[model samples]
Target chain A: MKSRFKTGIVAAVAAAGLLLSGCGPAATGAGGETLTFMFRGGADEKAAYTKAIGEFEKANDVKVNMIVTTPDDYSTKLKAAIAGKKVPDVFYVDPGSVQAYVKTGVVKNISEFVEGSDSIDLDNIWQYGVDSYRFDGKLMGQGDIYALPKDVGPFSFGYNKTMFDEAGIPLPSADTPYTFDEFVDVAKKLTKDTNADGKLDQWGTGLNVQWNLQPFVWSNGADWLNQDRSKVTVDTPEFAESLQWFADLQNVAKVTPSVGEAQTLDTYQRWMQGQIGFFPVGPWDVSTYEKLPFEWDLIPYPAGSTGKSATWTGTLGIAVSNSSKAPEKAVELAKFLSANETAQQSLVDAGVQIPNLIDMSDQWVKDSTTKPANKQEFLDIVKDYGRGLPANSTYSAEWYDELFKNIQPVLDGKKTAAQYLKEAQPKMQKYLDQANQAAGIG
Target chain B: MSTITRRSTLHRKEQRVALIFVALPVIGFAVFTIFPLLFSVYASFTEWNGISAPVFTGLANFQAMMVDPYFWQAMWNTLFLMIGIPIGLSLSLLLALALNRKMRGTTFFRTVYYVPVISSIAAVAILWQWAFNGDFGLINQALAMIGIDGPNWLANTATVKPAIIIMSVWKGMGYSMLLYLAALQSVPRHLYEAASLDGAGVLQQFRNVTLPMLRPVTFFLVVTSIIGGSQIFIEINIMTPGGGPEFASASIVWYIWQKAFNYLQMGYATSMSLVLGLIVFAVTAIQFRLNRRNQFSID
Candidate 1:
């Protein structure tokens, strides 16, 4: 009887195994030809994507699935997805992580897709944006062009008009922002104790010691990486001088908020709440400031002794995953979303982003009805002074990590700017050299 | 005789049924906990980034430990937190003793104290981060009122770890207090009576009688606190980003996370984690041995 029972169980197991084996492959996706799109904008941004996808789906007769997250969460999640071998068909790739992702063999090389498609437009994008999307002299992005740079607020100093007026300090002119020395003077003037309780009740400037501090370093003719993007250039005298100037904002001038105070007041939120005098920020804050009680103006970051106007641009693009079952369909979706004029215009109108197609983006200038009052100032500064950090693909992840990591001590008055840069130079150079060697950039 | 034998057979069948029911849980443990632990041990010796093909590099990860400053910093932070266990445990014991007697609103106090433990760590971290904020924070504002210059508690290298330790004690003590309460309730009242008869006052009775009786409970608390405190992660992670102000507050577990997830150095992270696990085991073992040796031995 036991032998019979064992035989019955064996038969049942065999039948179940056969059934599982016959169930067929994983979901081939969206009616057997699926394309996945990853983006970092919130739900309101979905309307723009939905309209774009609507047109693409109709044109290609394929289905598109959208994955969305905030910019901050996007990189970590994307890395996990790629590492897990569960990559979506298409995703937004930040310039910082693009090289790392491409090197991992997880993203599809879309150079061939661009060659094959004549309907996509490439001429409308800025040269730097286009170059940023390339790896190994071959385009790794799709649609014969770069991902549309939705709304951009170029690097500029945002200041409270009320504070400046109250202090009797004239606003920095659009033609030329205050020089490093004058900027320090202005910060001190803005720093005042309103309550007169023998305590610092108001701060002159909000000290963002990371990306915001970069333009100052660049203005002093210091670059994070050398011309060949092979070594760190920050240990130079120019960068050291810039760091000293930055340290003075706190230690000598007492104009900038302490790091702990910055966290509590949240420099950005405080600027929006009209508590700060001047803040260096990007276009991300425009929407927040639109509702503020005080008038605000955007001015270019001040030039240093070198007289160079250095403004670093942040570019986010879209790429296809190598594991995607439908590469061609993914490219089609990328092209339709980025190159199509109707889609770009609709997105721009929705305040989704500053569209990247230069010729087609005339609307950003022409749409007088939608443009903010300060739009002209922002546009003028970005047009004249804008430049992007060389997208040294593999090193940006580590380089920026070091940049942001080391700023804490500098801001806290523990390390001088010169000391921080001197210590960080070797670390930055080591990684940049590694990346350059890996990419054969030299 | 036949009926008696039948009854014995029935009893044997019941025992078999009980054994079969118990066997399922043992199989589950072997499959889940035991198997994964063994697999992790093997993986720790390999260079596997979550997605890539794993290569065996026997002890390179372990060798890397000698110069990893982050590892030492984490160890120091763990030791820093160990300071809290005794502080928390003693306070909890005191509270438990005071509340053990029938008193008005004792239940209310216990409930209010446990509220923090039930609250989310993230919520607590947010509140503490603000309170410790260098400027415009409640703590700083209060200090200003007293003409004291408050340091940036979360941002300053010297004060960050202490701030976290104090917050942890506040959040952690109630549970330990409840455990002490349970242990206190189980102690016999006759021992205290006998001590009092021998001319012992309240303090003397507590030291001689109540303490000896609470030895097992104290030993249990110390062992568990050592294990838990050594693996502390959430408070430091949420309150301070990668141990802020140049990693002055980095804990060991946070480094493991940064290496594994952010740096994509999983093999290195796992090896370091193994070393940490061994360290925790040795420390816990030593603690248990010490507690056993020091356990009150009353005649």
Candidate 2:
């Protein structure tokens, strides 16, 4: 009797397993193929994607599930999904994460798909955007492609044209990058009390030290790391000099908002309200910046003694998950987001970013009637002086963060930049060493 | 003889049924708590990035943690924030005593105080972030009216932890007040009457009668508050996303979460978390032992 009961249980289990296995092929059959695409963006970005994704769905004859999150939550959410082994079929992968993803085999090597696709014109896309996602096992920006660029963010500099005109200050030349000395002089005049009240309502510049200081540092021939990206080199005199100059913008020149005033409104909001004279503008800010009360135009960021302009370009790559069952469809979805002309046109029209296609952006630059009248500056940065973010080449951003962790004292002018960086290098190097260990590099 | 055999078989069947009913939580405990805890112990000694196989690295993570200034700073910040627990407890006790009297609109006051206790923590954190802003914030504006200048509450290192502690106390005081209120009312009136008859004043009576009666609740609150305080992440994450000016406001849990998720140093994070868990465990154990030793006084 016991033997019969066991046999009955075994038969039932067999039937259940068969029933579950039976549904797998049916779902993958013809029109039933579904792929998940995850990316982070704001409202306009979401609208642009929603409008563009349908064409891809119709063309591929498959369903696509879209997961959109705010930029702040994207990395954390993506990491959570990866850890749970439920990675989206295709998702936004940044240059910074390329090494970690490839090392762990989380991302598919989609070089062949990207290179061989007749629809994608690699020659027409920005080389820097494509190279940023490449990893040769030892270094980033060169090797097998793991993802395709969604949008290349050129961190262009924008000045309030209204503020410049109202103050009767000479407009900055679009082609010539202002020397740091000349830039500081203009900023001093731009910083003022427009209402003649004791409290200053207007400011020249309000740049976060973490984000905006990089441009000055790089233009000064100083960097967070050495050329080979192996060691921390922020203790150099050039870095300290640039760092001190940036601090002096607020503490000495009083051109930017005081720390207390900034805590209330922050620099970004100040720019939106036409209070700030100069600010960094990314391609992603176009849609939001359109409705600002003041006129603004792009120009090269101020140059240091090096006589060169420098700032980072940010990009997100759409990567296929290695674990995806529908790899071909997933790869196609990535390709569509990156290079499909119709999709790129729609997204550009939505005013979220410049077109990923270089040929398309050239035409975009020709349109001089926009809020940023000097749209050509955006292309120039993408094609030239804009460097990949320092963190992009590292295995993790902990070392980059270490540079900014105790920066407040310097910013407040309580400590000199030289002393601060001198003390900070070892701490940064420790984290860099940890990062190398993680990347399986010395 | 046959009847006896059948009765014994019925008892065995009932025992089996009872065992089946108890197995669910046992299985849950094993899966959820015991398994992760055991895995964490193993992972703490290894180099795991939450992906790929964990390689045993023996005490490297712990050794690094000892010299890591950020780790120590985070620990100090977490411990510093618990200073509010005692301050909050005293404030709640005073409030409970006030509300215990036959006051007008006691129920309304009770409900109002408990509102924050039930309000969403994230929303509260965001609301407080705006209020603590420096130039034009509610706090500085009020301070300015009194001929005083307020520093940037969330931006300055010295003020950031206090600002967070103050917000935490405001959010948590209501819950503790409610518990103390319940404990206050449950104290026997006869004890207070006896104390009063023995020439004890209100303060004397409170110390002799009310304090003793509230000991158990206080013990419970202190243990739980320390545990909760140790794990504070939401307020810190929202109010000061960059870990609050050199990480002066980072708690152990927040640091652990950053290491595990943001930095992808899961093994190091796990080791820090294990240290945190053991600390909490030791603290709770000590509290329980003390409570047991002092049980006679309450009795």
TM-score of chain A of 1: 0.84
Q: What TM-score results for chain B when candidate 1 is compared with the true chain B?
A: 0.89
The per-model lDDT (C-alpha) reads 0.71, 0.88
Clashing pairs for model 1 are A150-A353, A150-A354, A151-A353, A151-A354, A153-A283
Q: Over the stretch A275-295, how does candidate 1's per-residue lDDT look in tens digits? A: 678776565555555667887
**Chain A TM-score, each candidate:** 0.84, 0.91
lDDT (tens digit, per residue) of candidate 1 on B1-299: 99999999867865655555455567557766898688778778887655565678888777767776667877787788678888888888988988888989999999988899899998899899888878667888999999998988887778988888889889988898898899889878888888888999988988887887888888888888888887888888888975676777788888888777665567778888888889889988897788768866556
Lowest summed lDDT across 10 adjacent residues in model 1 chain B is found at: B15-24
Question: Which runs in model 2 stand beyond 4 Å of their true positions?
Answer: A1-31, B8-17, B297-299
Per-residue alpha-carbon lDDT of candidate 2 for residues A216-330, written as tens digits (9 for 90 to 100) = 9999999888866899999999999999999999899889999776652577888898899999998878888988987888989999979999988888898999999899989
| Top-TM-score structure, candidate number | 2
* Residue A194 in candidate 1, Cα distance off native in Å: 4.6
